[model samples]
Target: MKRKLLGVLLALALVTGLAPTVQAKTVPAGQTVGTVLFYVTDKAGERVLVSQVPVSEMVSDLKAGKVDNTLHNYSILDRYVTTVHQEAKGFTIPEFVTYAKEKSAQAALRAMELTFAGQDAIRLWEIDQTGFDDLDTYTCDELYGVARYNYPLLYKYWDYRTQEYADPDGKLTRDQAVSEILKSAEPEVPLLSVLAFSQRYMITDGKYGTGDYNMESLWYTSGLMDSERTPRFMKPMTKEDLTGKASTAADSRYWVATLLLNMKDAPEVTALGAVGVPSAVMTEDGANYYVRFSCPTQGAAIYYNHNLISPSYTPTSRYTGDAVVIPKTNFPGGTVTMTCRAVKDGWTDAGVQTLTLTSSGAEKGWISPYKDVTAGVWSYEAVGYVTQNKIMGGTAKTDFSPNAPMTRAALALALYHMAGSPKVSSGTGFADVPSGASYASAVAWASQNGVVNGTASGGFSPEAGITREQLAAMFYRYAKNVAKTDLTVSRDLSVYTDYADAGSWAKEGLSWAVGAGLVNGTSATELSPKGPATRAQTAAMLQRLGLFVG
Candidate 1:
């Protein structure tokens, strides 16, 4: 029996080649082995961040039976390390070169899996530069990048947001490739995910049920809310709402939706003095354009564009150093990752954008969609007001994406809608703002009305998000010029704590906003003037603007 048991274990190792191992070394309490990020992308290229845990915590969770402990079914290239540190396996990056010199690709690959299991810098290429199926002939001297998989979505709803219902993926038990979006991540940072639905789900039959949501085929997210708060949730589709369906037992239906983190406040890069930069970087020296991401000026809410790196700014770690500056570059296949952070006061919110680039090209996707306007959310009434008044519509027919950041083009459109969607003829005159674009007339109107000035590059960043101060400036102009309201300053910016943080360009508009109560201080003293404004915040501000403009 013992011989059989040993043989079984050995065969398992030999057949599977990649088997899970128990941690042999003890981790000290509170000691961080290393930080690790785990997330995945869908076919459309939208991001679904899973978790960002220290290696120590991951080990703890794995041992505590919290995450996926599934056996490997993919190739050895996909295998990840189970441990790190010198005492553990002592495998380092240069070993790839050494191993390549010593053995075939299979043996070298196996050696890498064993040596760098849980280390951050383990990756498999689609094809090395030599055009092989795998990394058969490795070339790079150092493999100093990120690779370690701990899938949070490979299994069923072991951790869906508080629902005892069926998963949200299938209809009619059909083999239909109905798209599913099940994002139930609990990342270390605060996120405000907006769910855009094509149609609301309801249970037609058990197999063909209609419903709002679930992790089995649903997705959920959380972040920044300043209004009447309640227990946060991600609702599964059913006859009732997600908040209400938590207790109804034996739920047999499933629905499908997506998980998109709002990247409006993601750190952005641009040319230093010029208003324009190349969106895609095909060169390592940045010859295409000067791509530089500046630090958030006044705790502005920047988003996590894909974690693409600056061609010039090399980071010591995978995601710690630089970020993609332009909006997004849509090449294909090859992925470059880095971390993007947003700072508000002393608190920092981290977001991830795994911007994949290739010399070939790439595409961008951070759309959480629209129409998740649930009750008890702070933006509920504001959204209603915007939609009912026809000032702003959702990204799609059913999605009123409240948490998504208000893009510059969207804001222009909203202002245009506020102005009753007036007709204009001439082009926007900016090269980027095409003559026939939907926003062309709006930009033309805004520029003619003095409500907007094109970027330093003399272009309208139609898709770029606006800072709160910028929002204030534009709204202030609209109020003064279009709404024809009082320009009195009821309060001074000095009354706020972080008054010094406001940029010189935004000071007067921010002050006026504060004075007129169009924009309130984030706290008693701090006014987050430069932060990115969400659709919810923009709607609320528009609603408030009506109080005086009316």
Candidate 2:
């Protein structure tokens, strides 16, 4: 059983690896601004930048670099660089670069706009390009361009008030220059806000690409990836994007979205119920132990580890059912704790449950080979014991015929085995008991031992069906003759409604059986002693008589 369970877990693991792969991060379509993106090439290199470029172009540039190893920097006008360096796996860089650039640019731009307002602001732009061209050597080409273009207006105004090419005591800082460039290069189309960023490159179908940029995708990817690999860029979604179509499992953004939507409403396992007796007598058939449990919501399935006592058991999607049957052999006679949980797609686990099981050691002998005697039947244990003890054999190799009536010959043979199959003192005692008959010696031994007697006309009716009262009388005689125990008068027979109808010869045995808790009346008041005994009833009675004791 343990080996079989292990095989199933390995199979599930293989299947999971073959299932569809989902991207860890996704980017929405269209232009985005004020968003910090990480451009990375494996563990060797990465760059942090705030870009106003369309998401599609950004992905294309990154992939091109990944292909050729010569990824060029994007146009500086549309992007603000925070830092440039290689980052090893599992390391995270600071996010202050984009923030600093945005703040510095906004401050410088605001200062310039206020200083050159009214009629002078128009005059401030009249300066020529000669003096500004030299400023190119002092900065990056993109930054120089922005500063150069704005330098003319500032120079003309300063000259009108102080007669100089620049402020001698107040040179523009780098932040101020970058700020001017940003203000002048602002795109005509409004930049979309960035909602989220990916910490790792998105790979799909053996090809790398950026997927949809939305909160659903953002949350989905976030839920799927570990904290170290989670995307860094995130922006709130607009009201319109919030009302977009729902995502499915096939979508990269689905899992995270589903997790967020259903987390709180996930089902919980309310209780676990074991189906039968906690302990069972181990047999050759290897009867299984069972458990039943339920969850609060529909579509929920139960998962459990087969080994109830192993501390290292890893829970997988191998076993699924509201009720599970575990082989008794796998768990020997001791306590075993079965761990279980309720799970479903799109919901959090309901948490684990533990069920304890107890089992007895294997019993010896030839157990019935019948398949019809299933576990949990009332007479199952008794039948197993009786068959294994060799007191009686099944009607055929594969059937016990437990519901069939027990004949006098069968009872005689069963008792004969119980008494160790002793040899008969004489050939045959009754006229009907023949020497060649299968139960001939059994009847002879039973008669000589005073366990049974012949009917009228000195004939042993071996083929006749034995009645409940007659069976009790035979058991009482055997107990006295073989077991050396006399019947005790414990309970009053008056409690039975049919007690008065019981024959004088059967009263003592019936009283003994009822007192020992070996037999019961058909109802609270009726003994029904004259009724024929079925195979199942006989097995039950034999078990109560301690046929398989010890």
Candidate 3:
């Protein structure tokens, strides 16, 4: 094969070096006969990907460093195959195999069968490699391109003792027949098998069938096997016997895997409910790990979210563990806080800050949202207003270090206070809370009031760190309980331009805060909700919400 390839290369070189003149020039289209490129479709006869041409355009794109084409192609092919497999349930193995293979083949074939400049040179390689096959490669004027065709055969490997499909031919067992078809249908070109199979013969055919047989199940299960294991594109599926959905697999899968791994073993739960925690960490160290910062050449905009526990991409690390990072760009200078730590542990340290944004376009007041107030009485009022008024104060000194984190206990107390500190029963002891804690009665009261529930384990980490989103959620609960009364969450703490962030969590609270002229952002777009609510800042927010009017 190597020698043949070398000889072909030499022949082509010789032709390039003027051999055509001595041989009477039989070749048409000069030396570009076999050179071809075109669009390729999926087995469903849909053109999912295309090869760019016009050498100039190709070169230009290459120089510009664009790679969207290859990525888009892979994405389309993956979706097409996955869709076919999922829809192939309840069909006979042979019928399913034939349909899937034909679709795959047609997609590749259509690409090669395209025409360009009145020339078509692509020829398909025979499976035997003995000679070229006309059926493999062809030209399509409609698509204006040429393509190489290949297809994959699908088969079932399960020993059907309980359920058996009718096999009339009697030439081969149902499993044997499917296996034989797969063995014989190997293609010489790239063949994307729609229904990927396991080595032990479990066919991934059923829809919503939880277990390892679902195509992506193997990947997810294997991803958990070895922490260091990295998956390649087409690695064969293994670890099948160990992976059929033990509990509800859907609960464990992320977005991508959930879309791919449709099975019966998946969780019956359909909706994802957001449970709020106070002071959710965004990143680790003094870097932008979870949050995204957008700075324009002249202006600045920051968009933040509390879903920073895991992200698609890791940001630059500065300190370690959920640290704030400010991106560097060409712009006017300003000062930003670099570090702010809670007096207690568990709660993440506010790592770093960027320089304060300049007073170029808009001007707003400045205040540290995470200010410490353990030292001063005036600071305590602000701290208490921020903590006790909102639903984030520690239910007890030991339950939640209001200064430490606003734990679940602290959240309940803050929420109760946010709801006018409603009174309720002090009955059955909570299995989670200690018997003699200050927040214990409040936690029980909060639960009785239908505000917050403890973990399934019946224990709430009274001293655990709280995230900003969680605090928002607590405020939300308080607002709902209080019959939509307005509470000032922030005012005069102008650090944002957008009011949307302020209105995001507790709409009623934000509305009240805004309507009462107590809470306003930096401008109209800068509502840094994810920014920590310091003792002073919280006090200011409560004052705006009408909490400490007395």
Best by TM-score: 2
Q: In model 3, how large is the Cα lDDT of residue 434?
A: 74
- Candidate 2 residue-wise lDDT, 1-550, digit = tens: 0011110111223333442354422222211121122111111121111111122222232333311222111111100111111111110012121221222111221121111111110000001111112211111122212221111112111211121222223465534533432343311111111122222111122221111211122333333322221212111122122122112111111101000101112222221211121112222335655543444433233444443335223222222221345566656664456554443321234334545545444434333478767766777767876786788788888888889999988999898998889877687678887899999999888888888887766787888889888898888788778776424322455645678777789888887666444566776456888989999889888866752121
49-76: candidate 3 lDDT, tens digit per residue: 1211112222222234331211100100
Q: What's the candidate order when arranged by decreasing lDDT?
A: 2, 1, 3
Cα lDDT tens digits, model 1, 1-550, are 0011110111223423343343322212222113222222223333322222223332333334443332211000101211100001111224322322122111212132222222222222110011112322212222223221221221222111221233434331211211111233222111111111111111222322222212211211211121111101111122122223222111110110111222223212111111111122332322221122333232122223332333211111211112233323422233434323332111222332223343333322122234487655666666766776778888787787778889888888788888887777777777888887877888888888888877777788888888888899888888778877656433445645578888888787886676555686676556887788988889888866654454
State which candidate, 1 or 3, has the greater lDDT: 1
TM-scores for every candidate against the unseen true structure: 0.34, 0.36, 0.24
Kindly indicate the candidate among 1 and 2 with the higher TM-score. Answer: 2
Each candidate: RMSD: 25.9, 31.4, 23.6
Full ranking by TM-score = 2, 1, 3
